[model samples]
Target: MWLKVIKFIAGILAIPLMAAVTRAFYGNIVGVVELAGILKYFMWGVGAYIVLHLLFFKPMFIYVLGHEAVHAVTSWVMGGKINSFKVSDKGGSVSTTKTNAVVELSPYFIPIYAIILMAVYFVVAYSYKINGAVFIFLIGFTLTLHLVMTIEVMKIRQPDLMKSGYLFSIVIVYVLNIIIIAMLFSLLFPSFSSKKFFADSYVFSRDIYAVIIRQMFF
Candidate 1:
């Protein structure tokens, strides 16, 4: 928890550093134009992203499954039993012996790791003018997964963590942002089912994390 607080502080401190880098790399106006293009890509990227997740990316499903598995396994390892685990096309959950800090956190961290891996891939894809299609794939996949996983992480049950008022408030604000973004995505792309999209991603993270934590700890 203290580590996370420090990370949060470091992230806040990095804003100015990022701003300086942006100014250095591309003067303000140019930076703005570049940023605009990236933003525009998001809509097209959204379609590409959904299609990839819905079809091409079996690894993403495995990662999500591992995430939930971590949560369930961790709970059991910490002396709790999983009463039920229900998986579906949309989403699923595991009713456990009980919730613990470590167990609850499993889902959150697995997605963070997955996000980092995706970030690395995105950086590499963009760095080299690799195929435009590849860049599109990386961008779409990473953005959609990152956004949805963030929603799930913030949604997890964590009363102990919430007892720290600061963390509790932060969670509320973060989840609200996730909700707003998801709504915006839904409005922009009416073809996808917002509820199913969010729920599936959420469950995937939790179960995959559960399995990971269970393996690591046990």
Candidate 2:
């Protein structure tokens, strides 16, 4: 009963949360014309993957592989032992000694391929300038792959959301994705400010929720 109420409230809160995050994200990226080249490559990467998606070339096995890997990795990071891992064309699964909201939902938010790519980029970037558009293109592609797969997966009933409570899981996944995206933008653009992105998110959240509360009660 209490859990149901909490989930219900969580679903309602997602509305303001989305609005605040969108504002914060837009505030950070809007009118930052200096890094237009980088943004272009990134967008090109996004569009490229989207085109592939339209053509039905998006690979389900790859996403399923990454999805299970993220679950296994997050489990390990949290001191949980992986029991078994499996991935097929239809879907994937991972068993861990421990399970939590983060473990169950990590695959939805963490683009494992893009994260691996970024890690490699940082290491290689330490010695050599990765100036080619190919890097950004790959980033865009993998992230979109993650996004598209996640959206498709989300449409069905997920045991993950059920374990965490669907409303709570939905809000958590969305907010974390927004934060992750803002952080990625900060990494890609020299002039983009992560601190400012967070600050804007905070300000928007505070103001919007305040108005919402006022209208509901006062």
Candidate 3:
């Protein structure tokens, strides 16, 4: 009963969370648009996404690996012992001694591949003068891959969502993905700071909430 109540509350909160994220996303885009020469690199990401789809490079194996890996990693971080980890082209899963919403739902929100690519980009860029175009292009490619794979996985009835209650899971996933998308835009545009992105979101959310209250009471 309490769990259901919590889920209901989470469902309600999801609306405002989504509104905040949308505001933040718009701000990130506006910041990117103001920067010169950055749009081309971003387009390279879009182009890479188009080419991958055209070539039918689904790479289901890698997706499965990352999915299971995220589950295992989060489980371990939560002080849980992984009993088994398996990955296949068809699907993959991780079994742990402990389970919670965070461990169960993390794979859907955290883009492990994108994070790895960012680390590699930093390392390689530090060692050599890498071409900015290629670096941004690869970032775009990997992030697009993550987004596609995430959408594909979510289309079916995922056991993880069942374990973490559908409403709660969806809310968490939606908000996190929005933040991730905004952060990616910030990464692409050096002029944008994540702090400002979040601050703008807070202000936008506050104004939205004030308007909502006025509509309900006034």
Off by over 4 Å in 1: 1-33, 49-63, 69-103, 106-129, 146-218
- Winner by TM-score between candidate 3 and candidate 1: 3
Structural similarity to truth (TM-score) of each candidate:
0.33, 0.93, 0.89
Compared with the true structure, model 3 gives a TM-score of: 0.89
Off by over 4 Å in 3: 33-35, 54-57, 184-188
What is the TM-score ranking, best to worst?
Answer: 2, 3, 1
Candidate 1 matches the true fold with a TM-score of 0.33
> How far out, in Å, is residue 27 in model 3?
1.2
Q: Model 3, poorest ten-residue lDDT window?
A: 30-39
Name the Cα RMSD for model 1: 16.5
lDDT of 1: 0.52
TM-score computed on alpha carbons, candidate 2: 0.93
The better-scoring model by lDDT among 1 and 3 is 3
**How well does candidate 1 score on lDDT at residue 193?**
43
Against the true structure, whose TM-score is highest?
2
- The 10 consecutive residues of candidate 2 with the worst lDDT sum are 31-40
**How well does candidate 2 score on lDDT at residue 85?**
95
